[model samples]
Target: MVSLSRVPQFTYQKLVHKIGSVDVLWFQHNSLDPELLMPKALFEVEHTTDIQNSLLKFQELRWFFVKMFIVADNKRRTEFAEKMKYSAFSELRNNKRVEFVSYDQLVGQYNMVSAQPSVSLLL
Candidate 1:
């Protein structure tokens, strides 16, 4: 199994105060789909933090395309999603490539995550 902590390139995005929530973004990519993965990591974060921030160091990332995703599971997640929608602006209406799937959907792809968050990601 791949241990995230071992991956030196990965970093955490900053926390933004959009609504009433505090969100943290993590950058990741699918090696098989380098182009799509690279860009995905770019807009993944939009905040600044004392800890390592992924979005802030997007320039250092060397990949093809970009894709962004959110990671919030508590009461603040809704605000994060809303902020994403607001940020997309025109893309939200004109584009059809982006999607916002539940974390469960992601786990199902690998057969590692269940319907419940606690059970998913093998946490």
Candidate 2:
């Protein structure tokens, strides 16, 4: 169940406002609260945009429990590392709250997961 910008009866209104319009936001449906949803992760796909902007967005939502990922080409890994050194981003860096995922790695991971047999296949 994927939604864009908004989710039907989402429970995290405050969080959504704070996060603004992130590239992707993963959520899990709450069985106990069927009408509401909980955020699981946040992903920012920066193919050519400034990496610091995405980092700043993550910084603002640092206290939240959601995982944060910056997806870009492998060549940008160094830039991501270098930007993390700034004092404004120290806490997130030191705590390892954010991660960098190469575009290839992300696709590979998706492929690998997709190749897995469905649970129903065993039945």
Candidate 3:
């Protein structure tokens, strides 16, 4: 279940399947019909926890259209690559169903977006 406290922007109640709790999930809602909402992306932030645990969760939800990402420290990129070589994760690796986002990359993106002026204000 997604916690409303984490995403206060969402006012409508959306249904998410029980694929275990993810660190962060982005949902796409139809503007015409707010009731129609679907998962757009899934992110797992692995700082101290085992990376394999996050991969296992992503493996189970690979069938969905949602984009999957594993966020971790840049130093762990090699660990991620090594784990992706495992036979069990062959499907995810071969198909490129998942991506890795380093903490620095994530923060950089956030900062870039924050630096941009709002379109509404510009208008």
Give the 10-residue window scoring lowest on summed lDDT in candidate 3: 8-17
Q: Candidate 1 residues 17-100, lDDT tens each?
A: 211121323345658765332222322322233212322232233222344343323444455445435443334324432234
Q: At residue 24, what lDDT does model 3 achieve? A: 83
User: For candidate 3, what is the TM-score?
Assistant: 0.78
Residue 65 of candidate 2: its Cα lDDT?
Answer: 79
Total backbone clashes of model 1?
A: 8
lDDT of 2 by residue, 1-123 (tens): 355555444546776776657888777777888666777788999999999999999998998878899999999999999999999999999999999999888877776666884522110
Clash totals for all models, in order? 8, 0, 0
Query: Candidate 3: lDDT of 101?
Result: 92
* Residue pairs in collision within model 3: none
Tens digit of lDDT per residue, candidate 3, span 12-100? Answer: 32324433378887766768878765666788998989889889888877776678889999999999999999898998998998889
The worst-scoring run of ten residues by lDDT in candidate 2 lies at: 114-123
